[model samples]
Target: MNSKMLQRQLKKLNLNPEEGPVNKKEWQDLIKLIDVTYNEYENHLYRSHNTLNVATDELQRLYTELEAKSSQKIQVLDSKLQNIMSMAPCIIMWLDNQGYIEGCNDYFRQLLNFNESLDNKKITLSDLDLHTLQVRAEEFIKSNLQQTSFTKQIANYYFKMTLNKMVGQNKISILGFDVTEDFNKQNTINQIQAKAVQSSKLAVLGELAAGVAHEINNPLMILTSVAFVVQKHIEQNKFDQLPEKLEKIQSTITRISRIVNGLRTYARDGENDPMMPVNIADVILESLELCVESIRYQNIEITFDNQMTIPAIVSCRDTQISQVILNLISNAKDAVLPLKEKWIKVILRQVEKNVVLEVMDSGSGISLDIREQIFQPFFTTKDVGNGTGLGLSISNEIIKTHYGRLFVDHNHPNTCFTIELPLA
Candidate 1:
């Protein structure tokens, strides 16, 4: 039905557009129009619904395609990263929080002597333990996890490692760099320094050799006189006093033997000398014996005051300790030789848990500015060609190695160098 026909029928039936129809023709036409309109609206709605369905299907297909591409890209990136880690020269590995080995790179596998066939295998920290390679894997992990980055020495090799905390995972990435060659080179330098210090000691002993020979001469003369007296006693048949003379000669010989032994020990060079309990007083006395001849010749009077009757024992290398004392005494002699009244005083005493030895000299005390620099290597106040300037420096190092201290005493009127060693 058309709009004109529907309007005329409604008007003839006296029906308002807003109210119900009265005429039968009006009602029939209205009903027909309603049916036709309903059919057209339904057709339009069905077309719109079909369009929406097509759009929804296309969107779902595009989302699935994008998701697949993203997963592929992620896999490729992961493969590239794994290849880079494998090709790296230094050791790299991923470890779980519980010290389990999650994955390791090629360098790390080679370091542990593992083949590439075990690349997919799950290896843990405990699997690395062996009798030949004593690795405390738990401690290693603990140290690294605690520090985040540190250097570790396993067997003879040194490795510097850095740790990275993983996101959303209970694991750490460990990156290692080998440093054994550099470490060995540093060790070689230290050995050379030790040898140089030993050589310096031998040079000082050479300078005192003449004085030592003179010291030996006095005992030789005493023995000669005692031999003559013994011969005279035998000729006169005076056996009662003969034993006394012989005892005196024996004592002199013993004294000479001790001096020679001390020199021999001081001159010997080796790395096998183990630390032991040493008598500080005896070390001082022996040192004095080595320097006495040179000191007396230079008009320097040296005195040793050991107050304790019992030995002041300390844990140290005996000869190295003696070397330090001799070096101090030699330096004192050089310092006070120009003074009018020259004297070197050595005092040995116990202070609490320490054994202290002070070597005091009459020279003008070291200046305030230079005292701090005196222990520095190659620092010297002596004229050119007179000193190597390493004696005090080496002595300081030796004392430090023994867990002792060598320092200058400023309270004394004279130049006093004090050495304090822990009591044994």
Candidate 2:
């Protein structure tokens, strides 16, 4: 969806924004959207810089190129500003400290609605003030110089005025920038850094969980085996009086074992790299087998569509890919809560040179606004303490390590998350 449409939808949802911090948050949300849509621009910034802070010739060249682009944008804005001057509905002016019209853009001239060009090129801030009514014009002028930046109602339009001390001289350069498009083109890269930090913490937690699971699995296995034997003895009429209790014990042990194992792998960092020309179909089947028991327990139907006859271009760590797939599948299952429609589709296809594996749920589709932020670590849509929000982010990183792609699709009624790998 376009920004305007999204904004209108937000308004309809009564997400009517307030000023100050609330407004900042709204802009931050928009900034995330911009990042997703403008990933290539960011990648350019990265590939052009010395990320390690080591100044290199390539970095310098990239920096120069970026500088050139910024200047180019500025020049375009400058020309557009002139055209807008006459067209603006407000009284706009570029004034000197001595209260003379240093210049006026088109918006200023156009507002007069007069083709008769005023020969007055020497109009100043004071002249505009007289036309603006001086009941508080003196205070406005004084405050304008004092504040360095502000917005005020002038001629029924919002005028955001800013003052800068022209370098090399002690004169103020006052100008107005149209907040129309917001021009919030600031490239805030800290999101990725924040994500990396969150992922690292989650990795640490996963590692601890893995160790605990491994340590307890053996004991749990032994206990579960003994419990089954006892349950069998009860079934054989050896302990018919305690049959119910034995069954309960057996069931509890199995549940705990599964939960423990779940925690262990959740924290893994793909410690081993074992790869071969493995059949991706086999991997998909194994992933399903790993989750089928849980899905069956919840009465959820599973669909596996593997139409990809083409082989993958690269061999990746199977366990790692499985972990990523399992994470996505788990999320899909959890999303279809309380709904009668309990179907999940796992589709694998070869699109050109890439292998695409998609897990689509029958739940409500994801919102476009949060879709980009979904892969951001620690930025979960789940309730507080319910999710660490690192699953997709870490999964994305894992895919990146393997030189693949990960994304969520909201183009359909069901939400689809896809992972693409290069064909080997």
The best candidate in terms of TM-score? 1
* Cα displacement (Å) at residue 56, model 1: 15
Q: How accurate is candidate 1 locally (lDDT)?
A: 0.81
Sequence-dependent TM-score of model 1:
0.73
**TM per prediction:** 0.73, 0.39
Using lDDT as the measure, the top candidate is 1
Model 1 clash pairs? none
Task: Give lDDT tens digits, candidate 1, residues 164-260.
Answer: 7776776777777898898789889989888878877986887788889888898999999999999999999989998899899999998898789
Candidate 1 minimal-lDDT segment of 10 residues: 129-138
The local distance difference test score of each candidate is 0.81, 0.64
Question: What are the per-model numbers of colliding residue pairs?
Answer: 0, 21
lDDT of 2 by residue, 218-273 (tens): 45776677677777876797875466656666666665665555444444545355
Off by over 4 Å in 1: 1-77, 94-102, 109-116, 119-134, 138-175, 270-272
